[model samples]
Target chain A: MANIHDVAKAAGVSISTVSYALSGKRSIGEETRRRIADAVRELGYRPNAGARMLASTRTNIFAVTAPLHSGTYEPAHMAFVLAVTRAARAYDYDVLLLTEDEATKGLRRVAASRLVDGVIVLDVSKDDERTKLLRELDIPAVVIGIPDDTEELVCVDLDFRAAAEQSVRRLADLGHRRIGLLGHPEQIYARGSNFPHRFRAGFLDAASALGVDAAFAMPGHGPVGVRAALDELFEKQPDMTGLVLNCEEPIQASVLDILADRGVRVPEDLSVISACSSFDTTRFHPPLDVIPLVAAETCVRAVELVVEQIAGAEGPHVELVPPHYSEHGSTAPVPDLRDAR
Target chain B: MANIHDVAKAAGVSISTVSYALSGKRSIGEETRRRIADAVRELGYRPNAGARMLASTRTNIFAVTAPLHSGTYEPAHMAFVLAVTRAARAYDYDVLLLTEDEATKGLRRVAASRLVDGVIVLDVSKDDERTKLLRELDIPAVVIGIPDDTEELVCVDLDFRAAAEQSVRRLADLGHRRIGLLGHPEQIYARGSNFPHRFRAGFLDAASALGVDAAFAMPGHGPVGVRAALDELFEKQPDMTGLVLNCEEPIQASVLDILADRGVRVPEDLSVISACSSFDTTRFHPPLDVIPLVAAETCVRAVELVVEQIAGAEGPHVELVPPHYSEHGSTAPVPDLRDAR
Candidate 1:
């Protein structure tokens, strides 16, 4: 069945433009829109979700470039790549994983060889070399994470800033005056990782606006790191009643365990929420209330954007997915400490 | 420096053949070895370790085909891919990830595309459709995990069966008379997953050989699953003195937590060991004694094997990485039940 890729290819516009023209998300040139319409008619394309996913095309391959940093493969990064690969498959497209030393050169090879019809770039930092290279390629490219300046690229990511703010606000709404935000490693911030930095900024902004006492810093990962971080948090804010964790999966349990060891009751004495990507937060002990960045959804969007662009979607679009947080088993109204006192 | 990939290309053979010809791991045809030597000498190729990773190739892209199962990505599987990508980067090659509906079709697409000089296939099952497909491809391919029969493949994997046996024997050596083995989900076994099945068989076989009573089955994942599995284990063997877990990461902590909650002291009353791919077993509370499958090592080996094959390595081969286990805080000499009585 004809799908978005075909219409975009036929129209010589980006997938986003075709989508915008179809859904009126953006203003498109009349000539381009007419071409798209003509292409849709000629190709018998259907702009439906299921059809978009199963859009079989001339080339059923995607190049996904998310390299391991210094031979250490981060699980979070893996989540993004995995999601994109799986999503591409939904469209009957195979993903060619690329972990290139130089993004520009790696992408150039893939594009030159026509190894893939589209490309999905993972873990875009501010001023990413990959994004710069994406502009030089004719193949449509989508980023799993947003770079600082996406003027010439199409990108999809969770609005991490909003997610962080929502998580902090959720704690505040639970009537907690003193809250804590545990983040990624210190080096992650020092290196100016866009996502972590955005989350940190959003968290602090929300905390300031709400007039809440907040402690923000990178937590050490694993049990030892969690112990040190937890001890430091309680020492810094003895009355802290909620925590927002932005660390890796390995450290979450240790955070709660340390709190429990210190006689702090979850929800009763302290509420905790995580800004994680996994949806199975409810299965964690005490079932954390969470603001999740659904990796799969973001990945699917990226694949669609890239495929359409390759088929002729518009250039340079940024799509920030909204936050999805739930008040599950972990968050509750703050206890009346004044009454206890 | 001219590296292995160059030699393989020049020799008109798979890189693996060149590696085997050099390392004597497999027998290479005399003519092919001579060709590889002639290519190496002509290209000025150096077989040094540093050069091995940075074997600057003409294509500089490797195709990795490990599709997400039913659009769901498994973390363990991701570990393998991540390792391969990182390892490839160390050698200055790019990976082209592929997930085709039919392994046959996917391998064909990647091989035919010439997008990648070589290929790496992840998680080879007993009768992996991909390996069968791999045999037809002109590209040199390495399978990360061993299949039921490797008569037509070069493969690398953790000797899972040996790892399981080591864990079971470790517990038995600790004087644990009865033990429980928690495993992967039921569908994994039902679908005839090779690795899990091998581990189970090995565990049971070792137990019988040691005259140690053992109970084993798939434990559902996460905290809830951990708790239920724990309850069932205890119920089945009230005097169970040891536990072997092959569950996911989320549930590992829960296992330790449940035992702690039950006033069961790790290593003091009961010993535990896991067949996991993660290397940070020591960071968990009580620092689990484990037989870890170093995904990174396997990945590095896969890349190496593939490169060598392209250089004309000989024969279908299986490289079984031995198990690496240690007596960490989670295991100890089993408490003497008679003495306690």
Candidate 2:
């Protein structure tokens, strides 16, 4: 909202001098130009002068780039991006969501065109190609997921590693000797999606530390995929009395139903824990005990982080939100399973 | 991509003459001014000349204004909006999603600032206040749902009335003499959300014409509401053999679970049909017999309509797409109650 007059007054220069320096229609002293530039940055002046388009290019809009129009429709991704929109508004900024076509192109266009001052990218892949472009750009950016190399980047995510470990520890503490984990789809891990790989590693580590058995399967998207994965896991750990679900697909219902149909009463014959966003709900079954992903909080933090970086906050920062698990209904003590054992 | 030079050549005027007509920085002949304006409109020249910022401000951005950060998270609304984002891109536009705070303020800010060429408002209420301001805006706009009044508004939505009527007619054709509809939450109807009211009216009309029995409930948000509504409906119509679900809360799975729990068999003891978005899916239960709401298609059409209007096409248009039902295994002929009767 600052104007040329305000910039001039703040920089202790005449109105025409500020205009001339910005316009380059005339040359001004380097020291004076530096003073004017600092004043403009301080005031966040969106210059209306014709030639100072560069000085006025900060649109106060942050682009939210996500794989929204991709083949898979993940509701949680939508949730995270929308939450980012809300969070950005608190900083008095608007959000331009880039969801269609090669997201990398969208990223480049917005930044190159000066359509946004900063950006927040969601569902980032480990070998994410966008980070390289973002790293090279002058615009500030933050990611909702960590990538393979965090050097010279700002990243924030629900600590999936801690979430997975907590989920396992919760079940193990409940006296469950054997458990199965329905992980992300195989491709997610193959693509080196940070969350799945981190979760799997954490689950394995926790299982080892707790001296309990853990069987893992990457669940498919649909019913058959979910059933086959569940069957495969159970086959490997037939005496499994605890389960951890780390996926957010519709398989939530399928898993509960399959277990029920297989005569496994939740938390009685089996206890199920979900490592997903607390907003997730399965319709037919008792709600799973959720180790919270805290999507909205994480989104808010990411926006603040990016905006801070944009406003000259220093350093390559990484924020990992600690786990806060919510127990709704899905967990209970392992039932007397000596007969099954 | 056209420039002032293109307009100058097309209008048979000097580049400065066209600039004068656009910038009002100098006087030009009346005939030449008219020619320049025509050429500008024809070319969609986003003028960079400073003073013409007001005269020729077309940012080629479409604002997607919805209550995304509000209380309840409706995935259908999210789906419709993300579809609009995808649809806008095909027309060479980007989406600026306004989700935080009063949506009217958001709408006002975007148009007043010339930040967007047009807007798409989703989850439009029956007596929406945004339409009035939009009518006053120079920028073109469209709504995803038709409000109480259609005069001078370009509106499009799934024909909920026809959808309701179709659901009933489909069941009637299958010999369903008695049916119940689980309508939206009582507050949604109370708040005058057009869809629920329209659906109920259509259902009543269709049932009357076919001389079939119909029961309705404005249920609550979750499983308990579903159960109470079903219990109340069946308590009145004890032999109710068909159901129409016209709600989108977490009750989809609950309904099926309750039916199965109560020893009622789908399509055997009862038939069920849904009047909701085609994107609506419950992971655990058998898919419903759904008359698709066509959210993505509706959203696509809405964007095209708004962008067309922005492209100088005038309209007070209304497009109501008829229902296209999908049989996903949750409906069938009514039970043979002849023996019981």
- lDDT per residue for candidate 1 within A1-341, as digits (tens), equals 45678888888988888888886777889899899889977875545322222233234567777655642335567667667877887786766666646455667765654545788887667778887777766568888776788887788888988898888888777688999888776767665466888788888898999889999766765567778787777789988888898876667767877777778888788888988546467767788888887887888888888778776756787898999888777887777753565
- C-alpha lDDT of all candidate models, in order: 0.74, 0.79
Model 2 chain B weakest 10-residue run by lDDT: B46-55
Q: Estimate, for each residue in A1-341, the C-alpha lDDT of model 2 and write its tens digit.
A: 56789999999999899889876889999999999999988986655422233346456788988865444445677778778887898887888888756478888777765667788988788888788888876679998889988888889998988998899889888888899889877877876667888888889999999999999998876768999999899899988989998876456767887887788888778888888654565444777788767778899999889888877985787889999888777888777644456
Chain A TM-scores, per candidate, are 0.78, 0.81
Model 1: number of backbone collisions: 37
Top-TM-score structure, candidate number: 2
Kindly list the per-residue Cα lDDT of model 1 for residues B73-192, writing each as its tens digit.
356777777688778877767666765453456566546544467888875667888777777665688887767878788888889889988988888877788999988767777665
DockQ scores of all models, one per candidate:
0.17, 0.24
